[model samples]
Target: MKLIGLVRSIRALGEVAEQGSFSAAAGVLGLTQSAVSQHIAALERETGLRLVDRGTRPMALTEAGHVLVRHGRTINARLEAAEQELAEIAGHRAGRLRFGSFPTALTTFVPAALGRLRTEHPTIVLTVVDDHMQGLVPRLTDGGLDLAVVYDHEALPAATTGPLRRVHLFDDPYRVILPARHRLARRRTALSLADLADEDWVGGHSGSAWFRIVRHACRAAGFDPRIQLSSDDYRAVQAFVAAGLGVALIPGLGLVSPTAGVEVRRLRAGAPVRRISVAHLDDEGQPPGVRAMIAILVDVTSHLRRAEPRRS
Candidate 1:
C-alpha cells in the first residue's frame, strides 16, 4: 500500500477514536464524512475485521478497532518525530552535505566556505572530496556529491543541461608568477602572455583544468610554453618559478596568501579568467541539506568578494 494511504488510514482511525463519531472525526481531519468512513472501511477490509460498533449512537470501537487504534497512536508518534527531524534538516540545523572541490578551491575558497558552514550549521556533517572538474562532474551526475565547486577558465558560461545546475560565483583572474630577478617581473601592471613566449613555464599537471587552460592560452599567444615542471599545487608552482625553473600562471584565489619566492602580477586584458562556480543536480526536488549547503556557499563567496580589494 502507498505510504500516504497508510498514514491517512491511521489518522482517520485515531481521529474517530478521539472524536467519537465519523462526522466529528471528518471535521477534525478536514476530510469529508464519507471519506473518513471510507478510510475506516478500507482499513477494516485490509485487516479483515469490523473496526466500529455501528449499533452504538456515538460510535465505540470494536476489539479490533481498539487494537488498531493503539498501533495508530504509535505510528502517529513516529510520524511526528520524523516531521521534526525533517524540519531540523530544512532549517540547516542538522543533516549532511557531500561537497567536492578542486585543489586551489580546497586551499582557498572551499575552506573559507566550510568554516562559514560550520559556524552557521554546526550539526551539519560534511564529506569533502578533492578532484578536478573532469572527475567531479561525473560523480555529481551519479549522485555521489551534493555539490561540486568547479571553475571554468575557458571564458564561457557553464553548460546548463540534464540534472546539472550551475551557479556562477565569481570571475577568478589568473596572474603571472615569476622569480624576482626575471625580466618583466617588475611589471606589476597588466602584462601580455605573448611576452612569456620565450620564457620556460611551470604549468599544472595533466588531468586538471588549469593545465589545459595554460596550454591553450600559450598556444593562442603564438608560442608553446616549454614547461619545466607541472604542479597543481600553487605553492609548489611558485617554488618552481622562484628557483627560475619557469614562470607560472596562478589564479587570484590562490594569490590570497602568496608564496615568498615569486612576484605575482596581473595578466593583460583578455588573459585567462576562471569562472568559479558551484554545480549541483537540479535542486527542484532535492533534500533540504543540499539547498542549505548551496546557500552557505553563496553567502561565503559573496562576503569574500566584498572584503577583497579589487585590482586593475
Candidate 2:
C-alpha cells in the first residue's frame, strides 16, 4: 500500500478516538462520513482486526488501532525528515568542503578567495585549516583535504606518492617590507636588494618555507640576512615590521591586499616569488561543487593578475 494511504488511515483512527464519532472524524479529515467508515473498514480488513469498538456508544479504537496510530505517526515523521535531507543534498544546499592552506596564504589570500566563494555559494560549507607545507601536504595526499592553497618556493620539500594534482594560481613576487617611518619608506620607491643588506631582519621559523625563500633572496643578492627575530608565525613577522623592529622580504602573495602599519616596496634586484597553487587528489573525481569552486579560484586569480600594474 502507498505510505500516504497508511498515514491517512492512522489519522482517521486518531480523529475517531479523539471525537468519539465517525461524522466528527470525517469533518476533521475533509471526507464524507461514509468515506471515513470505508477507510476504517479497509484498514480493519487489512490488519484482520476490528479497529473500532462497534459496541461502544460513540466510536473508539481497539487496542490494535491504538498501536497502529502510534507507529504510523513515528514512521511519517521519519519519512518527512529523510525527504528534507535528500532534497538538501540534491540541490547542493548543504554540504562541507574541507579546505587547507599555508599560514602565510591563509592570512590574506585565502580569506579573499573564500569570502568571494561564500558570498556566491553560501550552501557550500568550508572547513578551513592553516598549517605549514610540512603539515598540509600529508593531509592533502591522504584525502583529508578536498582543497588546498599551497605555497611553493624554488626548492620545495619532497612530496609523498599521493594522488594529488595542482593548478598554478599565481606567481607573486617577494617585496621588501619596512616600517612607514623608516628611511627606506621615506624614499617611497622600490629599493635594490643590495641596498637592504645592512638592515636588521624579522623572519619566520628557521626552516619554514618563507624563511628559506627570504634567505635565498638575500644570498642571491650577495649577503646573508641578519636575522633579528624569528618565529613560525607569519603574522609575527608583519607585527615586527609594523613595530619598526626590522626590515624583511615578504612574498608578493603575503601582500595580496593592503595591510596597515607596514610599507611594502618592490625590490629592484627582485626577491623570490613563490608559486601558489590549488591542489586536489587526481583519483578522486571532483564533485560538481568542487569543480565550481576551482572555476571561482581561476576567475579570481585572473582578476588579481589583470589588476596588477605593468611592472616593466
Candidate 3:
C-alpha cells in the first residue's frame, strides 16, 4: 500500500477502536462510513490479519488491531504536535526571523522596531546582521535572510532583481556638514553644491555607493569635488569635517546624534536623497513574524519622520 494510504488506514483503524463502530469513526474522522470500512479492510489485507471482530453488534479490535491502534495513537499524537507548531509559527506566536539592515538604520529606527516586535511576539527568535546595501541584497536573494532594511541613492538606484520585492520606508535627505568655524557654516540660508565646489570634500570610501552618489551630485553642480579624506564611518566623516579637513554630505538618518564642531545645513538645490526600503523574497506569502516586523518598521519610521525638526 502507498505510504499515505497506509497512514490514513492506521488512523481510521485507531478511530474505529476508540469509537466502537465504522460509522462513528467516519463521523469523527470526517470520512464516509464506506471510506472508513475500506481503510480498515486495506489495513487488514496489508497486515494479513483479521483485525476487527465484525460479528459483534459494536466493533471489537482483535489482538493485531489493538497493537496497530497503539502505534496509530502515537502517530496521531505526533501529527497533532507538528500541526500545532506550524499553526503557532503561522500565527506569529513562535518562529525564527533572520533579519538584516544597514549601519545607519541599525543605529536609528531599526532598534525601536525590533524592540516593539520582541515585546509583541516574545516567542519569536530574532537574528539580525548589519551590512551595506550591496551585502544585504545578495543575502535576501540567496535565502540567507528573511528580511532586510536597505537604501539607494537617487543617483544610483538599487538593483532589486530576481525574486525580491521592496517596500519604501522613507527618503533620507542629504545635508552638507561643514566645520563650525568654516565660512559656509555661518550662512543662514541653505548652501548650494556650487558653493562648496572649490572646497576639499570628506566622503565615503572611493568605490562605495555613498562616494559615487557624492561624486554624481558634485558633477551635477558642474564641478568634481576634491575629496581629501575618505571613511565609511559617518562619525569619522563628521569628525573630518569638524577638524576643518573638508566639507561632507551626510544623510539625515546617519546624523542621529551629530558630533560636536560640525554644522549641518540643507542643500539649496540638487541635494541627493537616499531612498530607504525594507526588502524580502517574493515568496507566496511572508511568514507572520516577517510581516509583523515590516509593520513595526513602517510605524517606527512614521514616528521618526514626525519627530524630526522642521528646520535643516
Measured by lDDT, the strongest candidate is: 3
Off by over 4 Å in 2: 1-95, 107-109, 115-125, 160-163, 256-261, 307-312
Best by TM-score: 3
CA deviation > 4 Å runs, candidate 3 = 1-93, 157-163, 304-312
Instruction: Please provide, for model 1 over 126-241, each residue's C-alpha lDDT reduced to its tens digit, 9 standing for 90 to 100.
Output: 78999867778766765667788887655222431224788877778788888988988876677888888888889877646777777777778888778879888788888888
Show the colliding residue pairs in model 3. Answer: none
What's model 2's lDDT at 159?
63
Candidates in order, TM-scores: namely 0.64, 0.62, 0.68
In model 3, what lDDT does residue 295 have? Answer: 90
Q: Kindly list the per-residue Cα lDDT of model 3 for residues 183-219, writing each as its tens digit.
A: 8888999989999999999999877879888899899
1 against 2, candidate with superior TM-score: 1
For model 1, the stretches where C-alpha displacement exceeds 4 angstroms are 1-94, 155-163, 303-312
Higher lDDT: candidate 1 or 2? 1
238-274 per-residue lDDT for model 2 (tens digits)? 7888898998877766666645789888776555777
At residue 266, give the lDDT of candidate 2: 79
Clashing pairs in 1: none
